[model samples]
Structure formats: C-alpha cells, structure tokens
Target: MKRLRLYFALFFILLAVPIVILLSHTYSNLEQESFFLYRRTAESLMATVYQRLQENLLVEEQRPYTHYRYIHVADRAVPQQEGLNLSPLADFPVQSKIPGILGYFQIDPDGSFHSPLLPDKDPAIAVPQREERQEMKDKLATLLEGLFSLTPGLQAQLDELKLEESPPTAKKNSSNFRDNLESRVDITLEQRYEREASESTYRLGSKEDPKTDSLQRRVQKSSLRQAEIFDSQLKDAYSQDLEKAKESAAPQRADDAPDSRVVAGQTNRAFQMGDELRSQDKDVLSEPEAEPEVVAEVDPFQSEVIDNRWLVFYRKVWPQQRRYIQGFAASLPEFLESHLDAAFLNSALPETASYLVFHQGELLEPTPAGQNNPRPLLLHSAALPYPLNDFDLAITVAQLPQSPAHQLVTFLALFLSVLFLGGFLGVYRLTVKQMELAQKKSDFVSAVSHELKTPLTAIRMYGEVLMEGWVEEEKKEGYYQQIHDESVRLSRLIQNVLTLAELERSEWQINLTTVQPVEFVAQITERLSNQVKRAGFEFETVSEGEVKPIQVDTDALTQILINLIDNAIKFSKDAETKKIVLTASQLGNDCYIRVRDFGPGIPSRKLKSIFEKFYRIDNEMTRTTRGTGIGLSLVKMLADAMGAHVDVANRQPGTEFSLRF
Candidate 1:
C-alpha cells in the first residue's frame, strides 16, 4: 500500500510540473502580443492624424513665412537727380517676390517717401474734382436716361410683376417699382458728383490766388466731410435695393386674379419666380444656432464672433485696403461639428462605439445616441502631432475580439488545467496498481521459501537418526512413525503451495459431490485429530441448522479443512485454553462451513487484509509457532474456486473465519 501511494504521488508530480511552466510562458507571450498590437495601432493612428491635421492647418491659416538675406542693390551711394524733389518710385523686384509685401518706397534727397501705387494727389483722401458743374449735371441726366443700371435682375423681375415698376407718366397712373429703384440709386450718385464739383470750385479759386492757404485748408476739410456723407448715402441706397428685391419675392398670395386680364399674369409670375431662384446665393455657410453667453469680464487675445462682420486678411504692407492679420471668429462647437463630425462617424469603428476629440481646450464628440454615454471598459487613445500636437482623441469600444492576448491566455490556462488533471489521475491509478502487484509478489516469494524448508528439515533429521541406528529397538518404531508424520506434513504443505500457485494463475478447478454432512465432518476430523493433539490444540467438528446432505469435492474439502484447522491451531497455540472447531450446516440451498478458534482476536483495522496472499497476523515479529503465512491464504483460494464466499469477524474470546458455499 505504501509503495502504491508513492507511485501515485510521483505520477501527479510528473503531470503537473511541466504544465505549470507551459502556462506561465503562454501568458507572458500573450501580454507581449497584446501590448505590441496596442502600440502598433497608436503609432499608426498618430502618424495619420498628424499628416491630415497639418494639411488642414496650412490650407486654412495660410500663415506668414519670412526669410532674411543681405541684398546689396548698389555697391556705392548713387547720386540723386538735382532737378527732382520727389522720392524714387516703387519698382523693386525683391518686394514683388516676398509674400504680403504691398510695395516699396525710397527716401529722396528732399526727405520725402514715395511709391508708384501711392503717386502724388492734390489732396489725400479727397474726391476727384470737375470744373463744369453744368456739363456733369447734363451727363447725369444722360445716365438717368438709361445708359446703365446696376440692378438688372431686380428690374427685370419687377417689370414682369408690373405692380409698381416705375413712377406714373400721369398723376393718376400707378408707379413703377423698377423705375423707382433705378432713380434712387442714380440720384444718390448724382448728388455725390454735384458735391465733388462744388469742392473743385474752391480748389480752383485757391490755385488762382497764391495767398489762400487758410481757405484751401478749410475747403479740403469740408470736402472730406461731404465725401464721407456721400459714401454713406450710396451704401444705404444699395442696401435698400437689396431689401426691396427680397421683400418682393417673399411667399404670399397674388393680389390679381388669374382671369382678370392681369398682363399674362401666370407667365409673368413664373418668370419672376425663376429670377428669384437664380438670384439667391448658392454658397450655404452655417451660423451658430445660439449665441455664446457673454461674460462679465473679457480676455485679451481671445475675441468672440461678431454678426455681419468678416475677419479678412490682406498683404502685410498694403495700402491699408484691409487688415494685415485677422482670425475668423467662429462658434467653437458648431464649426468643429460641421468639419469633423462626419469623419469620425464614418470611420472604421462600429456604430455603437464613441469617438471624442479635444483640441485647443475645446472638445468635439458625436451624439449618434442623442445623448453622451458613460465611459466604457475598453478604450483606445492617441495623441495628434505637429499642427495638432496639443490635441488627442479616444475611442470607447465594445467589440475588440476579447483583447486578443487575454482570450488566448485564458483558453490555454483552462485547457491545460483539465488536461493535466485528467492525465495525473489516469496515470496515478495505473501506476498504483502496478506497484501493489509487485509488492505482493515479493512477499509471496519470501513466505513460500520459509514454509517449504520447515517440514523438510524435520523429516530429514528423523530419517537420518533411523539410518544411523542411533536409537534402541523400542524407540526405533517411534522414530519411524515420527518420520512418516513429518513426511505427510511436508507433502501437505507442498500440495497447498502448489494449489495456491495454480489458483493465482486461474488454472485450478473444483469437482463437487453430494455427501452427508455428518459423514463429511467425521471423515475430515479422523485425519486431523491426532495431528492437532500432538501440537497441543484441542479440535472439534460440529453441525448446525438442518443436517442435510451437502455438495462437496471430497479431496478438496479435506485439504480446505486441513488448512483451516491448521491455521486455527497455529494462531491459538499460546491461548490459555487452546481449542478449534470446524462447523458444517445446510441453510436453504447453500452449505456453510465455519472454522472458529478461541485465541487473541484479530484487530478490526487489519481484518480485511488477513486473507490477502503472503499476509499474516504476526507482522511485527517472528512467531513461536512453526508455519508459513500461506495457510489461510490457501484456504481462501480453495473456497473461492469451489464458489464459496469467505468472511471474518472478531469472536468473543478469539476470531471467526467462515465460508458459505
């Protein structure tokens, strides 16, 4: 049993040790593989966003770039023209090549700066002058007679409507809307031209008289103020024309009935509808739905969007036609959504996944769910580089194939645990059985050797005494009888051993015969009475239950009883009142034979192991009785071959060994 246990321990150790190591390595590789994939995704995503963002920035901002170089246009100071007091004109090749440089100016010997684009004017920022006020007024009259019209589309549409196209030819006639718009625009320009003529009259008067400097200054100031007022008036007239056109095209029910002779009214209305459609601006620019809340305080360098005002850019050194540097004051949320929302929505991620982008301290996220979702368990993030280096984006994901490495590692660990455990249990059972068989075989060899030698030594000793004639004639017969008895004992011991060997090999069989129980017991007791008395053990044969005839193999039954009686005598030899009983009875269809003894009882724990081959009760020390351990073992084998069941129990004073056949 101990050897069997050791085999089991060894098998389990073999099965488990290697599997643990294999799983450890598998998990390590899984982690490395997962990390590699994550890093790979992050690196490629950053690179792609970097390239795209750089392009967007350059295309949108059109930033100023500068380069410096020392250009010597001349090796020596050039002589100035003695007659010319004005500065050199702006015709520099270098200035044209440089970005945003409007023009160049050089200081003349008279300390006056000049550029070709800014050539001399009589008075700066003043309107052009005309001498013939009457002739100009006549040209205006020619223009008003229809030489030109700025609002061609509105005028044509209003002509088809025939609602109010012009002022009436008669006092009672309805007005014409087209004529009214034209007169208003033309009259404003004519009025400004009239003011220009008046200013020119003052300049002409000042030029004729050399000492009218004061009068010239006053005239220039008055002309400048009048010019500003005229510009305002012209702008207002144009705006009014635009507003009138829009109002006329607004959706409303026509006042004139279709059949009431309304100047082919349907066709005219259709043409006007087409005109209105063609006049609308096609470029659709988005505006914020709601204005951003105003703060109590303002921050410098951070401006808000303004209505109807554009942030325009112009050449750096231009003639003040536009501002040099200006930023488009955009509503942050609306602008970003218009540009970036669709891109993220149509990306490789699933519809359920979320994408969030934060740039320049502002955040943009898609709301496909109509509301923002909570942060999910799995998320991948990457930072943008170059133009968008301060920006980052994250994707909250749900379907990532089980985190590739995590799935692999978990599967491997589960598979290995089951495989190793099954292997350990299977191999352990086989190994344990093998070990038990080997242990029993070794004990059998030692026991057989001891038993065979015991009877042979005694038989040879008495025979030699008779051969040597070492005894008187009176004792010679006793010696001869002793030799015969010893010979019989040796023969029976050899027969039992051979029978047990044949039984183990499955080569032994029994032939049963019907015999009277009383006769059966008497025949067996007659043979074993003298032999047991010589060993100082009293023996008896008894019957129980119904004394019916029993099926018995005569010779095998005799051997079976011999072994059982012998085992009882051997174990009970040291008892205070040594005795053995062989019992035979018929109960139902089976025969019961019991061999009982009055001796020290068997221990409860060792009872089951007593019938095993080469097993004995006196396992701790050699016994005083002369016997091998195979006596009871042979009895058990013979009983089983005869289709009998053997059982044992602790008797009141000793032990009970019984068989049911």
Candidate 2:
C-alpha cells in the first residue's frame, strides 16, 4: 500500500510540474506581447501628434505679411491724399486660426518698436482723424508692456527695440521721419523707375544698415547658422518652383507655333482696328501702366520660449539696406492645450497611455494624466520640428493594458488547469475504491472457506463415531441431533452463497403472488422458528391494524426472512435478553414486515453504507461472529427483485431491518 501511494504521488507531481511550467512560460510570452503591442500604439500616436502640429504650423507660416497691417487708399495720415498708402495694424481683436495670440509687433534694424496696432505719427494729420487710432494704439502698447514685463526674454527684446528707436545724438532728428520718407520715395519712384526703364535689375540690400553691433546681439550664433542653412535651402526650392511656373506661363515662341503667320496676321488686324477706333474718337486718353513690384528678401521664422510660459515667433526681413523683425507672441500653455491635447485625446494613444511636453528639460504644464509618481511601462520620446526645436514630446503609459490575445491565453490556461486537475482527481478516487473492493473480496473468500470447513468437519466426526460403534447408548440421540443441525446449518450456508451468485449474474427469477400480509408474516416466522430456536433465542410475532395483502414472490420473501432471522440469531445469540420480534403492519399505502433483534445497535454514522455489498460493521481480523458478510447483501437484493424496498434503522435496544411492499 505504501509503495502504491508513493507511485501515485510521483505520478501526480510529474503531471503537475509540466502544466505549471507551461502556464508560466505562456504568461511570460503574453506579457511581452502586450507590451510590444502598446509600444507600437504609443509610437503611432506620437507620430500622428507631430504631424498635426506641423500641419497647423504650416498654416501659420504661410500667412502673408500684408495681413499684419491695414490697407488704405492712401496713408492713414492723409485720407484725402491721392496716392496709395499702408497704415499701422488696428488694435481690434486679432483674427487668427492659432489660439492664444496676444498681438503682432515689428522691430526695425535700429531696434525701434513698431506694432500693427500703432500707426506712424504724422505732424500733418489732425488729432481728430487720429484720435480713435491713437487710443487703440495706446491700449495695445499697454497690453504688450504688461505681457512683456512678466517674461525676461520678451522684456529684453522690448528694451532692445527701445534702445534702437532712440537717437545717438540730439542732431539726429534731421535724419528722422521726414528725411526717411523722402529717401524711400526717391528710391521707389525715381531711382527704381530709372533702373526699370533702362532694363537693369536693382539688387536687393545694395545699401547696408551701418548699425551691425545690435543685430549681432539679437541673433545667436547657432540661430544664425540654422537660419542661413534653412534660408538657402528654401530659396533654392523656391527658385526651382518659380522657374517651372514661369516656363508653364510663358507664351509659345513663334518658331514653335504650328501657324506663326496666322497668329501674326490676327495680331496685325487687331492693332489696325484699335488705330481706326482711336482716330474716330479724339477724346480717348491712354491709362498709365502699372509698375512692377520689387520682392523683398524675408528670412524663415524662428521661435523662442520665454519663461517656459510664453512663445515668440519672429522672422528677419531685409528690404533694401534696412532690416526689420516681424513676429507674434502667444501663451505657450494655451497653444499646446489647444493643439496637442485635443489631437492626443482624439487619437488611439489615450486609450492606453498619456503624454508630456518638455522644453529644454523643463516640463510643460497641463500634462495629460496630471500625475507624476507612477512609473511608465512604455515610453516614447521625440524632438519637435523646427521653430519648436529643442522641445521634447514623451508618450507614457502607467500600466500597459492587456491585449485581446493575452486575455484569451489567460482564460484558456485557467480552463486547461481545471480540466487536468479534475481528471486526475477522478482517476485517484476510482483507483482507491477499486483497491478497497479487492481487499474486501479477499477477506470474504477466507471467511467462506472457514465457515464451510467447520460444519463439514463436525458432521464427519459424528458420522464416523456412529459407524465405529464408539458412542454410548444414552448419548446416541444427542449425536444424531448434533449431526442433523450441523447438516441444516451447512446446507443453509451453501444455499445463501448460491443465491448470491444467481442474483449478481441476473439469473434470479422472482414469481409474484398475492398473499395477505398477516399470513405472509406467519409463514415466514414459522419457517425460521426452528432455526432461531436451535440458536437458543426466543422469538415472537406481532400483527397490527388490518394489514393489507402484498404482491410479492413467496420464495424470494422466504429467503429474505431466513437471511434476516439467521443474521439476528448469529449476532445476538449471546445477548442478555435473547429475543427477536417479527412484525407485520400497514402504514399508509405500504405493508411492512420487520425483523428486529435485541443486539447492540448499528452506529449512526455508518447506517447508510451498511447495506452496500460485502460491507460489515466488524473488522474480519477481530470478529467473534460466525457468518460471512453476504447475508444482509443477499437479503437486500432478494427484496429489491420482488419490487420491495429494504431499510435498516436502530431500535431502542437493538437494530431493525424492514422490508416494505
């Protein structure tokens, strides 16, 4: 038994080890797979956010410079003036697609401050005409001042503009507005007209601003290098595009025309017709031709983050010899929230992770998750594009979510573990039951052999003594009685064994007959009365309450009664009050026959399993009783075959076996 148990334990361990290892391996793989899937999603979301920012920035970059100022028939100072003019930008709310814009401003090469909100001052214009404009200009300047005061970089830039606008000496007023305006008019109307009429190109920046120290301070070494590289590339691409556009727009050459003479003839005819009309109408006058506009050289825009909360976008413009800085200012937090946060929430990224923006190692405000303690499971970082250069974007996930495949694997593992353990447990229980049954059967064989041998040996000894004439005359009758009782007991034992075999093999046929319950009881008791008396026990019978007739097989019922009586006599033969009660009664719809013995009652906990085949209350090794265990088993089987039920219960002083029909 110990060896068998050891083998079972080893087998269980072998089976469980592989299953546990397999589950562990599967879990590890699933974890890695989930992380990989989340990482890819984070990467995709970051790329999408960057692309959206670039698209919006492209829109801001393409805005024309003319949008910053107001257009007028002439300058705002001379409303009645016949010439066209440009005025300062109005102080009304700025209309822009970008969010959080404060205002727009410009800085001249000499650091003079100029805003689209503030118009150029003129001594000729009346105060009434410029009153409303001056009010808006003052409000805009005050707003700018308040914003700049909070930002160090903005404050410095504003101070530089103020320094540039101030003259070095008192005599410099002669070279101020009036002379500057005249010089601009001479360059545009006189010198430019002459250069154009002479068919000669006037190069931009032919006159350089004498002040170089201030410009150097304003532009950093790295920023200048970047600007030069970017501007050069931009110009080359622009030139290629322009050449392609011009070639597409240029008129076809006469040599290339399919019918050059036809085209020439049509042109001549139109000219002749125009001349005739002009001759007929003497009052007609020719309109003056418009002059070709000269394009200025504008540098790419550059961005500066001020105090980590403000953003300044500025670009340098070189028109002739004078340099101007044109740009706008905005709240950095509002810009990122309006642009990046919305894009992130709308993307697939937020489903599994969050993001943070950092500029020069400083974290930007309005973080997605709004928490900073949790460690990120997956992190992806990328630098922003130009203008927002040096800014870093990080996508983080506090805990990576389980993927569908991982969830599926987990469910399957649980199911498999349950199934495997359940099967193993079932096999273990079945094997234990089989081993127990085998042990019981072995004990039954030894018991039956001893029972048969004792009876046969007694009968043989008495018969041998009578044949040898060795018995005294007075004891001869006692010897005969002894031999007859032993023969009856031996015959009964063989009959019980044979009946049990027939019942197990399904060869035991039951013939049913109707018999009165009282008569049935009387006949069963009469048949077993001698056997009980021989065992030296007093037996009694009782009938009650108009017992009904029962449908049963008399032979099978008789065998059932004999087994019960024999069991009672065997177990209680040594009791202090050796008595048995055979009862017949009608209780409700059923008729019952009971055989009760005055012996130690069966234990309560073992009551239910006592009727099982080969089950005995006493262990075979220490048993003092003299019967095989098959007596009660045979009684239960015979009763069941007759369509009756058997029940066992403990009486006050003994055990009762009932057969209900």
Candidate 3:
C-alpha cells in the first residue's frame, strides 16, 4: 500500500510536468500570434493616417507655393517681405504646427540650394552657408562650361549702362560699378519697372504739414524716376549689345563658333545646337543655361513626408506659367496629432494594442515597450510612401493585456493539477486500508488455529488416558474434569466461529421479546461467571433502579457477554488483580449492559476500529493472544441484528465494552 501510494504520487507529478510545459508552450504561441496581429493592425492604421495627411494637404494644392518660397533680404531702411516670413514654413496648413522649417528655396538651374531655416540667425552660421553656396555655384559653372557664354555678356551689359547714364564724365564711377558687378553672387535680372509704384512721383506732402520740405520730396521723387528710366534703358541696350557682339565675334558658319562656348537659353537663337546637357536635367533647364524640355504634368495635389519627418510638396505659383519646386518642414509629432491621430482614432483595431514608429536609427513617437525591450516582434514595416522623401520607416506594436477567456483557461489548468494530486492521495489511502485488512485477516486465521489446537490436544490426551485405564479413580476425576473443561472451551470457540460465519453471510436471526433488565443481567452474568472465575478475574454484576422490560434477544445477548468476558480475560493476563464487571441499567426507555475489565486499555487511536471483522488489537507480526480476531466482531454483528448498539472505550488501566437495548 505504501509503495502504491508512492508510485501514484510520482505518476501524478510526472503527469503534471507535461501539462505545465504544454500550457507554457501554448501561452508563448498565443503571445507571438497576438504580437503578429497587432503588427498588421498598426500597419493598416498608419496607412490610413498617411492617406488623411495627404488629403488635408491637398486643400492648398492649387493655391500656389508663393507664400512658402520668397527669400527677401532687408536693404536700406525697409525690410522687403514679398513672401518670406522669418519662420516661412510656419504658415503652411499641415506643416504650421512644427517650429523648425527652413524656407522654401530654389537654387538657380545649375546650382544646389542649401539654405537653413530662417528667423534671426547667427552671422557665424550664415557665413558658412554663404561660402558653401558660393562653392556650389563655382562647381556648377565648371560642369556647365558651354553655358558660360550666356554669363560673360551680363557684366559687360551692366558696365555699358553706367557709362551711357553718366555725364560725358565720371568714368571712374563707371569703372567702380563694373568691378562691383563682377563681385556680386546672384546675377538674376530684377525688373525695377515692375515695382508696385513704378513710374510714379512721391506723395509725402500733406496740407496739414505746411512746413514739410516739398522741394526736397520732389527731388527724391525725380531721382527715383531717373533710376527707373536707367533700369529700362539697361534692359533694352544689353539685348542689342549682346546680339551685336555675337554677330561680330562669330564665324559665318555655325560650325566655326568655339566649341567650348554655347549661348545657353530656352531657344536655339542663342546657340545653333543644344546638346551639351543630359536628357534627365531637361525638366530643370530654363533661360540663361539650358533649354526646357516638355514635361508631363504632375498632380499638384500630391504631398508626402520627407526623411520620415519633413513634408515635401509643390505649388505652381510662378507667374507667366513657369514651373518651380517648393516645400515646407514640420515637427513629426505635431503633425501626427494635428492630422494623423484622428484618422487612427477612427481605425478598427484592438483596444489592448498600442503603437510606436521607428525610422532609420531614431524612434519617432509613441515608443517601444521600454528601454530594455525591443518591439515584441517585427515584419510589417512601411517605408515613407512617397517618391520625394524616401525614408526607411517601421512601426512596432505591442499587444499587452490578455482576454478574460485566456485567464480562465490558465486558472482551469492550475485547478486540474490540484485535483490530480487530491485524487492520488484518496486512492492511496484506500489501498492502505485494504492492505491493513488483509494482514489482519491472515493473523486472525493463524491465531484461531493455535487456539483450537491447544484445546483439541488436551481433549484427545484425556480421552486416550481414560480409554486406556492408565489412572486410578482418584486421579481419574481430576483428568476427567480437565478433559471436560477443555471440551467446553473448545465448544465455545467453535460456537463463536459458527456464529460469526452466520452473521457474515446474513443468516443470523433475532427473536425479540420484552425482557426485564434484571433478568437480562442475571442471564449474562450466569453465562460469563464461570469463564471469568476460570480466568482468575474478580467478577461482579450490578443494576440501577427497578428496571423496566426491554426488547431483547436472549441467545444473542448471552453470546455478546461471553465474548466480551473472554476478550477481557485474554488481554488482562498481566494485570495484578484481574477484575471484570457486568452492569445492567435502565435510563429512559433503554437498558444498558457494560462489561469492563481492569487491564491495559485499548489504544485510543485504534478504539473505533476495534470491532471491524477480522481486525485485531495485537500487531499482526507479533500477536500473542490465544484467540481469533473475530470474537468482538461477532459481538458487534449479533448486537446489531438484535436491535442494539455496541461500543468500546479506553479507561484508566482498563478497557470498557458496552451494549445498549
């Protein structure tokens, strides 16, 4: 039984091992799958957000990029702010929320624009930019050597204007002006005739200001008029001088002109052939450098994110229907809340999931789980969705909280483990009980055989002596008495065995009758007194009150007392003064008979189990009492069949047995 319990315990533990592993495996898989699903949902949501941003930006598609592109420097007293604001991109609709935007700037067709964002900038930074821009222009001039033929005539044109405008003197002033033109960086023509108040006189005088210098204002106004005339004359004279120079310098045949120099412009009138530039650069080519190729129309409504953070877009605000490139810069976070967040708020995704975006090596907004944790997983990464700003971008989402049903499954798995342990314990206990009973039954058989043999041998010996006439009459009486006592004891053992067998097979019958308690006590004492006296135990009987007649079975009642007395005698062998008491009493409607012995009492732990069939108080391996284990069992079975209850209890230096009717 012990070994079986151990095996069962080990089995259950082994069983739990795989279950725990399975549950853990299942949970890990679910977590991974959930992370995958969240990744997909985040992708869908980001796509929608980007789409909405594009749509919102489209509202200003046709409205021209005039507001984003102007770069005017303050000259004299007035700050010329034609279009450029200090924070030029601050006014763009989608980009307005961001604080860091360099202005929209375009380099001349042959150079690169690398201007920084404008506000009040430090001179140290501006100086570097100026130097870099100058380098870029110099590099561009080298690459477009054929285009230099158009540039050389401009400095000469400015020198001729100052010469023609001066009195037939001031030749040194004209020479200084030509030297300054050569030093100037930007060479684009600015039409002074197109200024807002062109061809107009000054209007500074008012009637209320009677002392104002009207003559002084008139002189200033006349100076401005003369300047405007000078600008107009410069434009017309430069065109004529350029044509005359080309006509005089060129050979008669187109092939005869210097190959290193080509008059670069939109039309072939400046150069006979236009093959110096690559085909891809044609869209950007325009007057003064290269010819403009016919370009396919692009949707002006298009807009896109730049380098994962900036916004690159365009506006066709150029006058005379000329094409140009324009853009704006913005903070990515501000843009998300202002435009993208609403789109995501309306997307269909699990509420337990949250998201973060990472581009290149930088984490944009939201964030990964923590500093120590990478995004749970990765696969669905979307790059910036426009050709203009090609950025490597990705979003990682975490699905953190588990569902209620998932929690329930985990609970059930643990509960099942406990149940398995409980069941193993219960089964082990029952097996132990069975084994104990089996051992007790084997001990009972051996004890019963020993008891029967002792008496049977004595009877056989006395009968043989009497039959052989081996003793005189005086000794014969003692031998016959010994033989008779042995017979009687052997008969009692046989009768008890037969009775127990009958009870076990459900064949025992009860003849119940109304019997007085006094009579019942006398009947039990008469049957047990001889055996008690023979065992050298002091026996006594007592009854309380004039007992009423109680339902009783005389034969079964005698058997119960006889077995109790016999068991007491067997166990009380070591007592100094062996004593047995048979008491009868009446209380309420029941009569009680108690047979007690003064001897070592039954163990308190085993007291309740003392009456089990084939069960003995003596240890099975070292039983010394001369009786089968069934005597008390018979007592209990007969008493139960006769409408009575039997009980046993431990007492000081003794054990007590009782039957109630």
TM-score of each: 0.46, 0.65, 0.53
Instruction: Provide the lDDT at 258 for model 2.
Output: 30
Candidate 1 ranges with C-alpha deviation above 4 Å: 1-379, 383-453, 460-481, 515-519, 547-552, 585-590, 619-623
| lDDT tens digits, residue span 454-565, model 1 | 6678778888888898878899888877887878878887887788778889888778998887778888888778888888988788888787776767777778778777
Best by TM-score: 2
Better of 1 and 3 by TM-score: 3
Candidate 2: regions farther than 4 A off = 61-93, 99-334, 337-415, 469-474
Tell me the tens digit of each residue's lDDT in model 3 across 151-232. Answer: 3334434334431231111011122332332232111111222232222212111112222112121101112222222122
**1-661, model 2: which lDDT tens digit per residue?**
6777888889989989998898888876676555445545655665565566667666655554443433222212232322223332333465555678766776544444556553332122112224544555554455445433322235345434442442112111112333322321222322323433234321111223232112322212222222322232222333433333333333554334333223323322332343354458565568744433333455556677777767877766543323456777777888777766676677665454666666654556636553533445434445565556556665666565677877888888889878878887888778877887787787788788989999899999999999999999999998998998889888888998899899999998888899997887887778777877877898899997989888998888887888888888878877777999999999999999999999888899998877777777888898888887888888888988988999999988888999999
Which candidate comes out best when scored by lDDT? 2
lDDT computed for candidate 2: 0.62
Residue 257, model 2: Cα distance from true site in angstroms: 55
Q: What is the C-alpha lDDT of each candidate?
A: 0.48, 0.62, 0.52
Pick out the ten consecutive residues of candidate 3 with the lowest summed lDDT: 213-222
